[model samples]
Target: MPKQPDPARRSERSRQAILDATRELVSEVGYAKVSIEAIAARAGVGKQTIYRWWRSKGAVVFDSFLALSDAGEGDLALPDTGDIEADLKAVMRATVAEFADPAFSAPIRALNMEIIGDPGLAAQYLEKLAGPLDEAKKARLRSAQQAGQIAPDADLDLALELLYAPLYQRWLLRSGPLTPEYADALVDLTLKALRPSARP
Candidate 1:
Protein backbone atom coordinates (compact mmCIF):
# COMPACT_ATOMS: atom_id res chain seq x y z
CA MET A 1 0.00 0.00 0.00
CA PRO A 2 1.19 3.57 -0.77
CA LYS A 3 1.83 5.68 2.33
CA GLN A 4 0.57 9.23 2.63
CA PRO A 5 2.98 12.10 3.17
CA ASP A 6 3.10 13.85 6.53
CA PRO A 7 1.15 17.10 6.21
CA ALA A 8 3.04 18.72 9.08
CA ARG A 9 6.42 18.05 7.47
CA ARG A 10 5.22 19.42 4.18
CA SER A 11 3.88 22.54 5.89
CA GLU A 12 7.19 23.14 7.64
CA ARG A 13 9.05 22.83 4.35
CA SER A 14 6.72 25.38 2.76
CA ARG A 15 7.30 27.73 5.69
CA GLN A 16 11.05 27.48 5.31
CA ALA A 17 10.80 28.10 1.59
CA ILE A 18 8.81 31.27 2.15
CA LEU A 19 11.33 32.54 4.65
CA ASP A 20 14.22 31.74 2.32
CA ALA A 21 12.54 33.57 -0.54
CA THR A 22 11.99 36.61 1.66
CA ARG A 23 15.68 36.73 2.50
CA GLU A 24 16.87 36.38 -1.12
CA LEU A 25 14.43 39.00 -2.42
CA VAL A 26 15.38 41.47 0.27
CA SER A 27 19.10 40.93 -0.33
CA GLU A 28 18.74 41.33 -4.09
CA VAL A 29 16.26 44.23 -4.27
CA GLY A 30 16.42 45.80 -0.81
CA TYR A 31 13.71 45.53 1.85
CA ALA A 32 11.62 48.45 0.62
CA LYS A 33 11.24 46.85 -2.79
CA VAL A 34 10.25 43.38 -1.59
CA SER A 35 6.59 42.41 -1.58
CA ILE A 36 4.44 39.47 -0.48
CA GLU A 37 3.58 38.50 -4.05
CA ALA A 38 7.24 38.51 -5.00
CA ILE A 39 8.18 36.33 -2.05
CA ALA A 40 5.44 33.86 -2.88
CA ALA A 41 6.52 33.67 -6.51
CA ARG A 42 10.12 33.14 -5.51
CA ALA A 43 9.21 30.45 -3.00
CA GLY A 44 7.01 28.60 -5.52
CA VAL A 45 4.04 29.10 -3.21
CA GLY A 46 0.91 31.17 -3.66
CA LYS A 47 0.37 34.59 -2.15
CA GLN A 48 -2.32 33.11 0.05
CA THR A 49 0.24 30.75 1.56
CA ILE A 50 2.37 33.65 2.70
CA TYR A 51 -0.60 35.65 3.94
CA ARG A 52 -1.88 32.63 5.81
CA TRP A 53 1.41 32.29 7.68
CA TRP A 54 2.38 35.95 8.18
CA ARG A 55 0.38 39.02 9.00
CA SER A 56 2.42 41.34 6.77
CA LYS A 57 5.55 41.69 4.68
CA GLY A 58 7.44 43.10 7.67
CA ALA A 59 6.66 39.98 9.70
CA VAL A 60 7.91 37.72 6.93
CA VAL A 61 11.10 39.73 6.59
CA PHE A 62 11.70 39.61 10.32
CA ASP A 63 11.25 35.82 10.39
CA SER A 64 13.62 35.54 7.44
CA PHE A 65 16.22 37.52 9.38
CA LEU A 66 15.77 35.18 12.33
CA ALA A 67 16.19 32.16 10.06
CA LEU A 68 19.37 33.52 8.55
CA SER A 69 20.84 34.44 11.92
CA ASP A 70 20.02 31.09 13.54
CA ALA A 71 20.40 28.75 10.50
CA GLY A 72 17.51 26.70 11.94
CA GLU A 73 19.62 25.75 14.95
CA GLY A 74 18.78 27.16 18.38
CA ASP A 75 22.36 27.46 19.57
CA LEU A 76 22.55 30.80 21.36
CA ALA A 77 25.28 30.15 23.90
CA LEU A 78 28.62 31.96 23.75
CA PRO A 79 31.95 30.23 24.13
CA ASP A 80 33.34 29.88 27.66
CA THR A 81 36.97 28.85 27.90
CA GLY A 82 37.46 29.77 31.60
CA ASP A 83 39.29 32.84 30.29
CA ILE A 84 36.55 35.46 30.04
CA GLU A 85 38.68 38.07 28.35
CA ALA A 86 39.89 35.73 25.63
CA ASP A 87 36.41 34.38 24.99
CA LEU A 88 34.94 37.86 24.75
CA LYS A 89 37.70 39.05 22.43
CA ALA A 90 37.20 36.08 20.13
CA VAL A 91 33.44 36.67 20.00
CA MET A 92 33.83 40.39 19.36
CA ARG A 93 36.34 39.86 16.57
CA ALA A 94 33.99 37.40 14.90
CA THR A 95 31.20 39.97 15.14
CA VAL A 96 33.39 42.58 13.45
CA ALA A 97 34.20 40.19 10.63
CA GLU A 98 30.53 39.29 10.18
CA PHE A 99 29.46 42.93 10.00
CA ALA A 100 32.14 43.53 7.38
CA ASP A 101 30.60 40.95 5.07
CA PRO A 102 28.22 42.48 2.53
CA ALA A 103 25.83 39.53 2.51
CA PHE A 104 25.33 39.75 6.28
CA SER A 105 25.51 43.52 6.59
CA ALA A 106 22.75 44.25 4.09
CA PRO A 107 20.07 42.05 5.62
CA ILE A 108 21.02 43.07 9.16
CA ARG A 109 20.82 46.77 8.33
CA ALA A 110 17.50 46.31 6.61
CA LEU A 111 16.10 44.43 9.59
CA ASN A 112 17.31 47.16 11.95
CA MET A 113 15.50 49.74 9.88
CA GLU A 114 12.35 47.63 9.91
CA ILE A 115 12.47 47.20 13.69
CA ILE A 116 13.12 50.90 14.26
CA GLY A 117 10.05 51.86 12.27
CA ASP A 118 7.68 49.32 13.79
CA PRO A 119 7.24 49.25 17.55
CA GLY A 120 5.50 45.88 17.52
CA LEU A 121 8.21 44.36 15.43
CA ALA A 122 10.86 45.92 17.63
CA ALA A 123 9.29 44.31 20.70
CA GLN A 124 9.15 40.96 18.97
CA TYR A 125 12.79 41.26 17.91
CA LEU A 126 13.89 42.11 21.41
CA GLU A 127 11.99 39.23 22.93
CA LYS A 128 12.87 36.61 20.35
CA LEU A 129 16.40 37.59 19.30
CA ALA A 130 18.16 40.24 21.36
CA GLY A 131 16.85 39.12 24.74
CA PRO A 132 18.03 35.53 24.37
CA LEU A 133 21.43 36.62 23.05
CA ASP A 134 21.84 39.05 25.91
CA GLU A 135 21.00 36.38 28.48
CA ALA A 136 23.59 34.01 27.07
CA LYS A 137 26.25 36.72 27.28
CA LYS A 138 25.24 37.56 30.81
CA ALA A 139 25.58 33.93 31.75
CA ARG A 140 29.20 34.08 30.64
CA LEU A 141 29.72 37.26 32.58
CA ARG A 142 28.25 35.64 35.68
CA SER A 143 30.78 32.82 35.35
CA ALA A 144 33.55 35.38 35.19
CA GLN A 145 32.17 37.09 38.24
CA GLN A 146 32.14 33.83 40.19
CA ALA A 147 35.79 33.36 39.25
CA GLY A 148 36.52 36.81 40.72
CA GLN A 149 37.65 38.17 37.36
CA ILE A 150 34.86 40.74 37.34
CA ALA A 151 33.45 42.81 40.18
CA PRO A 152 31.03 40.86 42.30
CA ASP A 153 28.43 43.59 41.97
CA ALA A 154 29.02 44.32 38.31
CA ASP A 155 25.94 44.87 36.21
CA LEU A 156 26.23 42.36 33.37
CA ASP A 157 23.77 44.20 31.17
CA LEU A 158 25.68 47.45 31.40
CA ALA A 159 28.95 45.64 30.84
CA LEU A 160 27.59 44.12 27.64
CA GLU A 161 26.35 47.48 26.36
CA LEU A 162 29.73 48.99 27.08
CA LEU A 163 31.39 46.28 25.05
CA TYR A 164 29.02 46.16 22.08
CA ALA A 165 27.27 49.54 21.79
CA PRO A 166 30.21 51.32 20.21
CA LEU A 167 30.81 48.55 17.69
CA TYR A 168 27.14 48.56 16.72
CA GLN A 169 27.08 52.35 16.40
CA ARG A 170 30.12 52.40 14.17
CA TRP A 171 28.66 49.72 11.94
CA LEU A 172 25.23 51.34 11.76
CA LEU A 173 26.58 54.80 10.96
CA ARG A 174 29.40 53.64 8.69
CA SER A 175 31.56 56.01 10.69
CA GLY A 176 34.45 53.63 11.32
CA PRO A 177 35.90 50.34 10.14
CA LEU A 178 34.80 47.17 11.90
CA THR A 179 38.21 45.65 12.48
CA PRO A 180 39.65 42.96 14.75
CA GLU A 181 41.77 45.64 16.41
CA TYR A 182 38.69 47.71 17.14
CA ALA A 183 36.90 44.71 18.61
CA ASP A 184 39.87 43.85 20.81
CA ALA A 185 40.11 47.43 21.97
CA LEU A 186 36.45 47.47 22.95
CA VAL A 187 36.84 44.23 24.89
CA ASP A 188 39.92 45.54 26.65
CA LEU A 189 38.21 48.72 27.73
CA THR A 190 35.09 46.92 28.90
CA LEU A 191 37.09 44.40 30.90
CA LYS A 192 39.14 47.09 32.58
CA ALA A 193 35.99 48.84 33.65
CA LEU A 194 34.39 45.64 34.95
CA ARG A 195 37.49 44.14 36.57
CA PRO A 196 37.48 43.72 40.33
CA SER A 197 39.22 46.45 42.31
CA ALA A 198 42.48 45.67 44.11
CA ARG A 199 42.01 44.40 47.65
CA PRO A 200 43.58 45.87 50.81
Candidate 2:
Protein backbone atom coordinates (compact mmCIF):
# COMPACT_ATOMS: atom_id res chain seq x y z
CA MET A 1 0.00 0.00 0.00
CA PRO A 2 1.12 3.55 -0.70
CA LYS A 3 2.17 5.58 2.32
CA GLN A 4 -0.48 8.00 3.57
CA PRO A 5 0.12 11.75 3.40
CA ASP A 6 0.86 13.51 6.68
CA PRO A 7 -2.30 15.09 8.07
CA ALA A 8 -0.34 17.79 9.94
CA ARG A 9 1.48 18.86 6.76
CA ARG A 10 -1.76 18.87 4.81
CA SER A 11 -3.45 21.02 7.45
CA GLU A 12 -0.59 23.52 7.48
CA ARG A 13 -0.78 23.86 3.71
CA SER A 14 -4.50 24.50 3.90
CA ARG A 15 -4.02 27.14 6.57
CA GLN A 16 -1.38 28.97 4.52
CA ALA A 17 -3.57 28.78 1.43
CA ILE A 18 -6.39 30.41 3.35
CA LEU A 19 -4.12 33.24 4.49
CA ASP A 20 -2.62 33.78 1.02
CA ALA A 21 -6.08 33.89 -0.50
CA THR A 22 -7.26 36.40 2.09
CA ARG A 23 -4.31 38.72 1.35
CA GLU A 24 -4.91 38.51 -2.39
CA LEU A 25 -8.64 39.24 -2.14
CA VAL A 26 -8.12 42.14 0.23
CA SER A 27 -5.64 43.66 -2.22
CA GLU A 28 -7.76 43.08 -5.35
CA VAL A 29 -10.93 44.33 -3.74
CA GLY A 30 -10.93 46.79 -0.85
CA TYR A 31 -11.29 45.37 2.64
CA ALA A 32 -14.93 46.47 3.01
CA LYS A 33 -16.00 44.28 0.09
CA VAL A 34 -14.11 41.07 0.90
CA SER A 35 -16.22 38.20 2.18
CA ILE A 36 -15.42 34.95 3.90
CA GLU A 37 -17.31 33.06 1.21
CA ALA A 38 -15.09 34.52 -1.46
CA ILE A 39 -11.96 33.69 0.50
CA ALA A 40 -13.14 30.11 0.96
CA ALA A 41 -13.71 29.73 -2.77
CA ARG A 42 -10.33 31.21 -3.66
CA ALA A 43 -8.50 29.05 -1.17
CA GLY A 44 -10.27 25.88 -2.31
CA VAL A 45 -11.43 25.31 1.25
CA GLY A 46 -14.94 25.09 2.61
CA LYS A 47 -16.51 27.88 4.66
CA GLN A 48 -16.72 25.44 7.55
CA THR A 49 -12.96 24.91 7.33
CA ILE A 50 -12.25 28.63 7.58
CA TYR A 51 -14.71 28.96 10.44
CA ARG A 52 -13.05 26.10 12.27
CA TRP A 53 -9.72 27.95 12.14
CA TRP A 54 -10.82 31.59 12.40
CA ARG A 55 -13.75 33.12 14.24
CA SER A 56 -14.57 35.91 11.80
CA LYS A 57 -13.61 37.53 8.54
CA GLY A 58 -11.66 40.14 10.47
CA ALA A 59 -9.74 37.47 12.33
CA VAL A 60 -8.77 35.75 9.11
CA VAL A 61 -7.71 39.00 7.50
CA PHE A 62 -5.69 39.95 10.56
CA ASP A 63 -3.91 36.60 10.53
CA SER A 64 -3.08 37.01 6.88
CA PHE A 65 -1.25 40.26 7.64
CA LEU A 66 0.33 38.71 10.68
CA ALA A 67 1.62 35.92 8.46
CA LEU A 68 3.34 38.47 6.27
CA SER A 69 5.15 39.92 9.27
CA ASP A 70 5.98 36.50 10.60
CA ALA A 71 7.73 35.70 7.35
CA GLY A 72 10.76 37.32 8.96
CA GLU A 73 10.89 34.11 11.03
CA GLY A 74 12.82 35.44 13.98
CA ASP A 75 12.78 37.89 16.85
CA LEU A 76 12.33 41.46 15.61
CA ALA A 77 15.25 43.85 15.98
CA LEU A 78 16.11 47.22 14.48
CA PRO A 79 19.51 48.12 13.09
CA ASP A 80 22.09 49.39 15.58
CA THR A 81 24.65 51.37 13.64
CA GLY A 82 25.82 53.30 16.76
CA ASP A 83 24.31 56.44 15.23
CA ILE A 84 20.69 56.57 16.31
CA GLU A 85 19.83 59.31 13.82
CA ALA A 86 21.06 57.40 10.79
CA ASP A 87 19.43 54.19 11.95
CA LEU A 88 16.11 55.91 12.55
CA LYS A 89 16.28 57.67 9.20
CA ALA A 90 16.83 54.38 7.43
CA VAL A 91 13.90 52.77 9.20
CA MET A 92 11.53 55.65 8.52
CA ARG A 93 12.49 55.76 4.85
CA ALA A 94 11.86 52.03 4.53
CA THR A 95 8.45 52.50 6.13
CA VAL A 96 7.63 55.26 3.67
CA ALA A 97 8.62 53.04 0.78
CA GLU A 98 6.43 50.22 2.08
CA PHE A 99 3.43 52.51 2.42
CA ALA A 100 4.02 53.58 -1.17
CA ASP A 101 4.04 50.02 -2.50
CA PRO A 102 0.65 48.76 -3.60
CA ALA A 103 1.38 45.15 -2.57
CA PHE A 104 2.22 46.14 0.98
CA SER A 105 -0.03 49.16 1.34
CA ALA A 106 -3.20 47.47 0.22
CA PRO A 107 -3.09 44.65 2.77
CA ILE A 108 -1.92 47.02 5.48
CA ARG A 109 -4.87 49.31 4.77
CA ALA A 110 -7.15 46.30 5.08
CA LEU A 111 -5.58 45.30 8.39
CA ASN A 112 -5.97 48.82 9.75
CA MET A 113 -9.67 48.89 8.85
CA GLU A 114 -10.30 45.49 10.41
CA ILE A 115 -8.55 46.48 13.62
CA ILE A 116 -10.42 49.75 13.89
CA GLY A 117 -13.86 48.16 13.95
CA ASP A 118 -13.08 45.11 16.09
CA PRO A 119 -11.84 45.85 19.58
CA GLY A 120 -10.78 42.25 20.09
CA LEU A 121 -8.84 42.29 16.82
CA ALA A 122 -7.31 45.59 17.80
CA ALA A 123 -6.07 44.11 21.04
CA GLN A 124 -4.70 41.12 19.20
CA TYR A 125 -2.93 43.45 16.78
CA LEU A 126 -1.28 45.22 19.69
CA GLU A 127 -0.22 42.06 21.42
CA LYS A 128 0.83 40.10 18.35
CA LEU A 129 2.21 42.81 16.10
CA ALA A 130 2.47 46.46 17.13
CA GLY A 131 3.56 45.83 20.69
CA PRO A 132 6.53 43.73 19.66
CA LEU A 133 7.61 46.08 16.87
CA ASP A 134 7.38 49.01 19.28
CA GLU A 135 9.49 47.19 21.80
CA ALA A 136 12.16 46.58 19.21
CA LYS A 137 12.28 50.23 18.26
CA LYS A 138 12.34 51.24 21.91
CA ALA A 139 15.36 49.05 22.40
CA ARG A 140 17.21 51.26 19.92
CA LEU A 141 16.07 54.40 21.72
CA ARG A 142 17.22 52.99 25.02
CA SER A 143 20.61 52.40 23.49
CA ALA A 144 20.63 56.02 22.35
CA GLN A 145 19.84 57.18 25.88
CA GLN A 146 22.82 55.27 27.19
CA ALA A 147 24.95 57.09 24.62
CA GLY A 148 23.58 60.46 25.83
CA GLN A 149 22.05 61.03 22.38
CA ILE A 150 18.50 61.07 23.70
CA ALA A 151 17.38 62.41 27.04
CA PRO A 152 17.62 59.65 29.60
CA ASP A 153 14.36 60.77 31.10
CA ALA A 154 12.56 60.75 27.76
CA ASP A 155 9.44 58.62 27.58
CA LEU A 156 10.33 56.09 24.89
CA ASP A 157 6.67 55.51 24.03
CA LEU A 158 6.10 59.18 23.33
CA ALA A 159 9.40 59.39 21.56
CA LEU A 160 8.26 56.67 19.17
CA GLU A 161 4.89 58.34 18.61
CA LEU A 162 6.64 61.57 17.75
CA LEU A 163 8.83 59.77 15.28
CA TYR A 164 6.21 57.66 13.50
CA ALA A 165 2.70 58.98 14.03
CA PRO A 166 2.82 61.75 11.41
CA LEU A 167 4.02 59.43 8.70
CA TYR A 168 1.17 57.10 9.56
CA GLN A 169 -1.40 59.89 9.67
CA ARG A 170 -0.36 61.26 6.28
CA TRP A 171 -0.49 57.79 4.77
CA LEU A 172 -3.91 57.05 6.25
CA LEU A 173 -5.45 60.37 5.24
CA ARG A 174 -3.67 60.72 1.88
CA SER A 175 -2.93 64.22 3.07
CA GLY A 176 0.49 64.35 1.45
CA PRO A 177 2.90 62.37 -0.65
CA LEU A 178 5.12 59.99 1.33
CA THR A 179 8.62 60.55 0.08
CA PRO A 180 12.19 59.90 1.21
CA GLU A 181 12.59 63.59 1.97
CA TYR A 182 9.44 63.54 4.07
CA ALA A 183 10.70 60.54 6.05
CA ASP A 184 14.06 62.23 6.69
CA ALA A 185 12.35 65.40 7.89
CA LEU A 186 10.18 63.50 10.34
CA VAL A 187 13.29 61.84 11.77
CA ASP A 188 15.17 65.14 12.11
CA LEU A 189 12.26 66.88 13.82
CA THR A 190 11.67 64.01 16.25
CA LEU A 191 15.34 63.71 17.15
CA LYS A 192 15.45 67.42 17.92
CA ALA A 193 12.53 66.99 20.29
CA LEU A 194 14.24 63.97 21.89
CA ARG A 195 17.67 65.58 22.28
CA PRO A 196 19.24 65.37 25.72
CA SER A 197 18.20 68.25 27.97
CA ALA A 198 20.88 70.85 28.63
CA ARG A 199 22.23 71.03 32.21
CA PRO A 200 21.21 74.10 34.19
Candidate 3:
Protein backbone atom coordinates (compact mmCIF):
# COMPACT_ATOMS: atom_id res chain seq x y z
CA MET A 1 0.00 0.00 0.00
CA PRO A 2 1.12 3.59 -0.59
CA LYS A 3 2.36 5.39 2.51
CA GLN A 4 -0.03 7.81 4.17
CA PRO A 5 0.60 11.51 3.59
CA ASP A 6 2.04 13.52 6.48
CA PRO A 7 -0.22 15.92 8.42
CA ALA A 8 1.74 19.03 7.27
CA ARG A 9 1.61 17.97 3.62
CA ARG A 10 -2.14 17.37 3.85
CA SER A 11 -2.62 20.79 5.49
CA GLU A 12 -0.65 22.49 2.73
CA ARG A 13 -2.71 20.77 0.03
CA SER A 14 -5.95 21.83 1.69
CA ARG A 15 -4.83 25.46 1.95
CA GLN A 16 -3.77 25.58 -1.70
CA ALA A 17 -7.05 24.04 -2.81
CA ILE A 18 -9.04 26.58 -0.84
CA LEU A 19 -7.07 29.47 -2.33
CA ASP A 20 -7.42 28.09 -5.85
CA ALA A 21 -11.16 27.70 -5.34
CA THR A 22 -11.38 31.30 -4.16
CA ARG A 23 -9.60 32.58 -7.30
CA GLU A 24 -11.80 30.60 -9.67
CA LEU A 25 -14.96 31.72 -7.91
CA VAL A 26 -13.90 35.35 -7.86
CA SER A 27 -13.12 35.27 -11.57
CA GLU A 28 -16.48 33.67 -12.43
CA VAL A 29 -18.65 35.63 -10.05
CA GLY A 30 -17.88 39.09 -8.77
CA TYR A 31 -16.63 39.38 -5.19
CA ALA A 32 -20.21 40.04 -4.07
CA LYS A 33 -21.27 36.57 -5.27
CA VAL A 34 -18.28 34.64 -3.96
CA SER A 35 -19.03 32.94 -0.64
CA ILE A 36 -17.35 30.53 1.72
CA GLU A 37 -19.87 27.81 0.95
CA ALA A 38 -19.34 28.29 -2.75
CA ILE A 39 -15.59 28.09 -2.32
CA ALA A 40 -15.83 24.94 -0.22
CA ALA A 41 -18.10 23.28 -2.80
CA ARG A 42 -15.88 24.33 -5.68
CA ALA A 43 -12.73 23.15 -3.89
CA GLY A 44 -14.30 19.75 -3.16
CA VAL A 45 -13.48 20.21 0.48
CA GLY A 46 -15.75 20.18 3.50
CA LYS A 47 -17.22 23.55 4.53
CA GLN A 48 -15.74 22.99 7.96
CA THR A 49 -12.30 22.72 6.42
CA ILE A 50 -12.63 26.19 4.94
CA TYR A 51 -14.03 27.63 8.16
CA ARG A 52 -11.07 26.10 10.02
CA TRP A 53 -8.75 28.30 7.95
CA TRP A 54 -10.62 31.55 7.13
CA ARG A 55 -13.06 33.48 9.26
CA SER A 56 -14.67 35.28 6.32
CA LYS A 57 -14.78 35.27 2.53
CA GLY A 58 -12.78 38.52 2.39
CA ALA A 59 -9.75 36.80 3.86
CA VAL A 60 -9.95 34.14 1.19
CA VAL A 61 -10.19 36.81 -1.52
CA PHE A 62 -7.18 38.63 -0.12
CA ASP A 63 -5.17 35.42 -0.05
CA SER A 64 -6.02 34.77 -3.69
CA PHE A 65 -4.93 38.32 -4.59
CA LEU A 66 -1.62 37.83 -2.83
CA ALA A 67 -1.09 34.62 -4.80
CA LEU A 68 -1.86 36.33 -8.11
CA SER A 69 0.31 39.33 -7.23
CA ASP A 70 3.28 37.12 -6.31
CA ALA A 71 3.14 35.44 -9.71
CA GLY A 72 5.18 38.53 -10.86
CA GLU A 73 3.42 38.83 -14.19
CA GLY A 74 1.96 42.06 -12.86
CA ASP A 75 3.58 45.44 -12.18
CA LEU A 76 4.76 44.57 -8.68
CA ALA A 77 8.18 46.27 -8.80
CA LEU A 78 9.84 49.10 -10.71
CA PRO A 79 13.11 48.61 -12.52
CA ASP A 80 16.11 50.46 -11.06
CA THR A 81 18.29 51.40 -14.02
CA GLY A 82 19.66 54.60 -12.38
CA ASP A 83 17.88 56.48 -15.16
CA ILE A 84 14.58 57.62 -13.73
CA GLU A 85 12.94 58.45 -17.06
CA ALA A 86 13.70 55.07 -18.62
CA ASP A 87 12.79 53.23 -15.42
CA LEU A 88 9.51 55.13 -15.17
CA LYS A 89 8.62 54.41 -18.79
CA ALA A 90 9.46 50.74 -18.41
CA VAL A 91 7.35 50.45 -15.27
CA MET A 92 4.50 52.47 -16.75
CA ARG A 93 4.39 50.38 -19.93
CA ALA A 94 4.33 47.24 -17.82
CA THR A 95 1.58 48.74 -15.68
CA VAL A 96 -0.56 49.60 -18.71
CA ALA A 97 -0.23 46.09 -20.11
CA GLU A 98 -0.95 44.45 -16.76
CA PHE A 99 -3.96 46.66 -16.11
CA ALA A 100 -5.24 45.94 -19.59
CA ASP A 101 -5.06 42.17 -19.10
CA PRO A 102 -8.52 40.58 -18.95
CA ALA A 103 -7.58 38.26 -16.09
CA PHE A 104 -6.87 41.23 -13.77
CA SER A 105 -9.23 43.97 -15.00
CA ALA A 106 -12.70 42.92 -13.86
CA PRO A 107 -11.94 41.76 -10.34
CA ILE A 108 -9.64 44.72 -9.76
CA ARG A 109 -12.19 47.20 -11.11
CA ALA A 110 -14.89 45.69 -8.94
CA LEU A 111 -12.66 45.67 -5.89
CA ASN A 112 -11.71 49.31 -6.39
CA MET A 113 -15.31 50.42 -6.76
CA GLU A 114 -16.38 48.42 -3.72
CA ILE A 115 -13.57 49.88 -1.67
CA ILE A 116 -14.57 53.39 -2.72
CA GLY A 117 -18.20 52.88 -1.78
CA ASP A 118 -17.43 51.34 1.62
CA PRO A 119 -15.48 53.63 3.94
CA GLY A 120 -14.48 51.00 6.51
CA LEU A 121 -13.42 48.63 3.77
CA ALA A 122 -11.66 51.48 2.00
CA ALA A 123 -9.42 52.02 5.04
CA GLN A 124 -8.55 48.34 5.09
CA TYR A 125 -7.92 48.29 1.36
CA LEU A 126 -5.69 51.38 1.53
CA GLU A 127 -3.61 49.80 4.28
CA LYS A 128 -3.29 46.59 2.29
CA LEU A 129 -2.82 47.83 -1.27
CA ALA A 130 -2.68 51.59 -1.86
CA GLY A 131 -0.39 52.40 1.05
CA PRO A 132 2.30 49.94 -0.01
CA LEU A 133 2.14 50.98 -3.63
CA ASP A 134 2.52 54.64 -2.67
CA GLU A 135 5.47 53.88 -0.42
CA ALA A 136 7.19 51.95 -3.20
CA LYS A 137 6.70 54.88 -5.57
CA LYS A 138 8.12 57.25 -2.99
CA ALA A 139 11.19 55.05 -2.69
CA ARG A 140 11.69 55.23 -6.45
CA LEU A 141 11.38 59.00 -6.43
CA ARG A 142 13.91 59.27 -3.59
CA SER A 143 16.34 57.10 -5.52
CA ALA A 144 16.04 59.47 -8.47
CA GLN A 145 16.61 62.41 -6.14
CA GLN A 146 19.87 60.92 -4.83
CA ALA A 147 21.02 60.40 -8.39
CA GLY A 148 20.30 64.07 -9.22
CA GLN A 149 18.15 63.11 -12.18
CA ILE A 150 15.17 64.64 -10.44
CA ALA A 151 15.28 67.90 -8.43
CA PRO A 152 17.05 67.81 -5.09
CA ASP A 153 14.14 69.66 -3.51
CA ALA A 154 11.61 67.35 -5.11
CA ASP A 155 8.72 66.50 -2.84
CA LEU A 156 8.45 62.74 -3.02
CA ASP A 157 4.87 63.05 -1.88
CA LEU A 158 3.85 65.51 -4.58
CA ALA A 159 6.10 63.85 -7.12
CA LEU A 160 4.33 60.60 -6.39
CA GLU A 161 1.06 62.29 -7.24
CA LEU A 162 2.45 63.83 -10.42
CA LEU A 163 3.82 60.46 -11.48
CA TYR A 164 0.57 58.56 -11.08
CA ALA A 165 -2.36 61.00 -11.25
CA PRO A 166 -2.54 60.75 -15.05
CA LEU A 167 -2.29 56.98 -15.02
CA TYR A 168 -4.79 56.61 -12.19
CA GLN A 169 -7.11 59.04 -13.87
CA ARG A 170 -7.00 56.81 -16.93
CA TRP A 171 -7.23 53.47 -15.15
CA LEU A 172 -9.99 54.27 -12.66
CA LEU A 173 -11.84 57.00 -14.49
CA ARG A 174 -11.35 55.63 -18.02
CA SER A 175 -10.62 59.11 -19.32
CA GLY A 176 -8.06 57.65 -21.74
CA PRO A 177 -5.96 54.65 -22.61
CA LEU A 178 -2.60 54.25 -20.83
CA THR A 179 -0.68 53.55 -24.00
CA PRO A 180 3.11 53.12 -24.23
CA GLU A 181 3.52 56.44 -25.97
CA TYR A 182 1.37 58.14 -23.35
CA ALA A 183 3.55 56.72 -20.59
CA ASP A 184 6.75 57.73 -22.34
CA ALA A 185 5.37 61.20 -22.98
CA LEU A 186 4.38 61.59 -19.32
CA VAL A 187 7.88 60.65 -18.15
CA ASP A 188 9.57 62.95 -20.63
CA LEU A 189 7.33 65.89 -19.83
CA THR A 190 7.71 65.29 -16.10
CA LEU A 191 11.50 65.27 -16.31
CA LYS A 192 11.59 68.47 -18.31
CA ALA A 193 9.05 70.20 -16.08
CA LEU A 194 10.32 69.03 -12.71
CA ARG A 195 14.07 69.13 -13.17
CA PRO A 196 15.97 71.90 -11.34
CA SER A 197 17.20 74.70 -13.56
CA ALA A 198 20.82 74.27 -14.69
CA ARG A 199 21.63 77.65 -13.11
CA PRO A 200 20.59 76.27 -9.71
Give the top-scoring candidate (TM-score): 1
Encode model 2's per-residue lDDT on 16-94: one tens digit a residue: 9999999999887867789999999999999999999898886787678767753235456888989999999988888
**lDDT scores in order:** 0.86, 0.86, 0.75
Tell me how many residue pairs clash in candidate 3. Answer: 0
- Which tens-of-lDDT digit does each residue in 1-200 have in candidate 3? 43666877888788888888887777777777788989888888998998887777776676666566543243555678898888988877777777777687666777767677879767766665566677777788788888888888877777777767788778888888768888888778777777976984
Q: What is the C-alpha RMSD of each candidate to the true structure, in Å?
A: 3.7, 4.3, 4.4
In Å, residue 148's CA in model 1 sits off its true spot by: 1.5
TM-score of each predicted structure versus truth: 0.79, 0.76, 0.74
Q: Number of clashing residue pairs in every model? A: 0, 0, 0
- When 1 and 3 are scored with lDDT, the better candidate is 1
Runs of candidate 1 exceeding 4 Å displacement: 1-15, 27-38, 46-60, 70-72
In terms of lDDT, the poorest run of 10 residues in model 3 is 68-77
Candidate 1 overall lDDT versus native: 0.86
Query: For candidate 1, which ten residues in a row score worst on lDDT?
Result: 65-74
What candidate 3 gets wrong by more than 4 Å, as runs, is 1-17, 27-29, 44-59, 69-77
State the RMSD for candidate 2.
4.3
Once fitted onto the true fold, the runs of candidate 2 whose alpha carbons sit more than 4 angstroms away are: 1-16, 25-60, 67-71
